[model samples]
Target: MKKKYVRLISRAAVWSPRFGGLAFLILLFSILLQRFSVIDVTVFMILIIISACCVVVSLFFAVKALYSLWVYGALGGMKALRGIIYSLTTAIPLVLFWGFWFTLPALHDVSTDIQRPPTFFRTARPSDALPLKSVLIEQAALQMSQWPEMSGRRYDGSPDRIRESVLNVLAAYDWPVIAQKKFKGEEDELYIETVAKSFYLGFISDIVIRLIDEGDTTFVDMRSASRYLPRDFGANAAFIIDFMEALDTEIALLPLSQDEK
Candidate 1:
């Protein structure tokens, strides 16, 4: 009986790292597959669950291996140490993956213009709507506290010049504008709609940019809302900031007028 138990522990020790490594691979693949839309969301979700279970089982085996190593010492101890090292190394990525989310808010929708957010023509409605007054207030406060730099920007240029800069930046990034319209009435206003996709999970986020003529300057306001997840971990804000910075860079690169300079 003692020999049988020792053998069983030894076998588990050898397999723990393999199971943990397998779980890590499945998780990595699930993220990649989801990003490319190669697998159904439900299937990917199941993969995550299965991967978690595998990790748990691996952990159990690892503990058993440690116990066996302590009892048998020598060769058994060395084998168990190898399994522990492999399992710990394999679990690092998964640990970081979830650890990153712990810092972000649990809200899906994000907008630079919370006061008068640009309309979402093709995108889905925000998860926190008017009826959810408390939720909206909390989200607003959170964004204000976390990302005050996400607000609108004013460019010192003619409406046409600013519009050109915006279009140039958008095109340079290959954002694939879905709908864009410019109407000249009381004020020259341009509305543009685009989509942003995540690098890992291929998650979609709808973005809107509104440019309105303000006499000698043009005012730009943008809003970005995710299509699926309730929390984006500041991706939407990052997208808006990137576009604004790119637009500024593009505008600066343009030839300057003698009078303006």
Candidate 2:
């Protein structure tokens, strides 16, 4: 019961009009608050994007003023309203800069579920361990009656394990894939997608699973990966770990380097 309450409170922290608000006032207020307070982000990362853009704008204008002394004679140059213009110009940069800073505490605090980097595990074949794609497909079909498709099958396992499952599934199939293949330094990624009328069903997890000797976006980058993970979709924390475990047992995983831990 205590654990349940903790979970409930953690959830309720973001359970507000701030996260679900659709009106202009609500959105504006959420953004403004997110500039300082951690937000419950359920939608596309409007908060981070907005804050970043604001920070950049503030920084740009502030930096631009530095050169104005020589180029435009301090920007407020000898005008009748020079005093007012100078003060306002100076305030603009301060406001924007502080806006980003104030929101730092909230923005910097990310869920531990997403705080880890991808670990590398090298694998040779799908049958060598477990067929990851088949597992999800089987489970989804059994549970949701949906078929999970493979994006690739180059059977290299990483600590990230998401790609391991992808490679495992692709290895199981002889079907021609519409997705890109593994290049010299590039590794394959696995995405399970299902679209329905009520809403869209997708396994959007990604990571750069560094392959042994092969490297270059081995997994999807995290900056935008929030779409599939708990951060964006509020998914189960154990999903990625479970996927990785399934891959480990079904497929071969050899660590290229020490695991990220």
Candidate 3:
């Protein structure tokens, strides 16, 4: 009977290694998560240390459990503690590390940005060749970068307030304003020209706002350019808000039904 009991314990110990191996694999993933760049470096580093300790501690417990069960013919408390320790420690860091690791990078991808501005040779003007005006606008919009503000970092103002503020600025600057027909859909393209110096300026909307100077109007545009607007305003932020506000203003003036909302 004693020999049979010992044989059973030895087999369980052999199988016990499989559990530790699986847990080690999970710990490896957690370690990699801690290395991601978008994760807050401080948080990641702290968790990384914790995770390393967890891996080592879990391994110790696992080995202790096997040794106690198979080598000594008894598990003591190590058998239960082994699964509990390894699972809890591994699970916690794995969830936390990967959560921040994947989320931040996707949220802040520079390519997705549409609020950056393009370089401009000068301020865009109505005069000169139409081809030049079209090309400049197209190129400028293409170069625009995404706005980086997230839900947490967003300003107190809503899109409506922002649009109103922007329009008020445009009116203050004596810049001719036109209300877009709609939100300009996902992509908004425009060709506007103002005659000024020999240099001309063009603007585009994307993650970053790109401005290109095509003619003698090397001067920056104060109305549409971020230089004239708020630095936090993203590529489509100003344009979208202002357009939406203009639509609302037009609707208010029309005396439409309240049910429309």
Best by TM-score: 1
User: After aligning candidate 2 to the native by TM-score, how far in Å is the CA of 3 from where it should be?
Assistant: 60
- Could you say which candidate leads in lDDT? 1
Give the alpha carbon lDDT tens digit for every residue of 1-261 in model 2.
Answer: 355422111212122222222222333555555433344333324543553344344334444444454454453222213322333444454465457445422111111123332321322222322222211222222222211221212344342454544456434432222233333324343333211110122323222222322232233321112222232222222333333445445655544534443
Model 3, CA-based lDDT: 0.37
* Candidate 1: tens digits of C-alpha lDDT, residues 1-261: 355432444776777777877877888889888888787556776887787777777788778877776777413455555556655665676676566667777766666677667775554444542211112444788888888877788888776778777778878877878887877788888888888887667767778898888888889888777765656767888888888888778877878756478
Local lDDT at 177 for model 2? 29
**Alpha-carbon RMSD to native, per candidate:** 4.5, 22.3, 16.4
**Which ranges in model 3 have alpha carbons more than 4 Å from their true place?**
1-40, 78-83, 86-89, 92-261
lDDT, candidate 3, residue 173?
Answer: 34
C-alpha root-mean-square deviation, candidate 2: 22.3
User: Between candidates 1 and 3, which one is better according to TM-score?
Assistant: 1
- TM-scores, in order shown? 0.80, 0.23, 0.29
Per-candidate Cα lDDT values, in order, are 0.73, 0.33, 0.37
| Best first by TM-score, ranked | 1, 3, 2
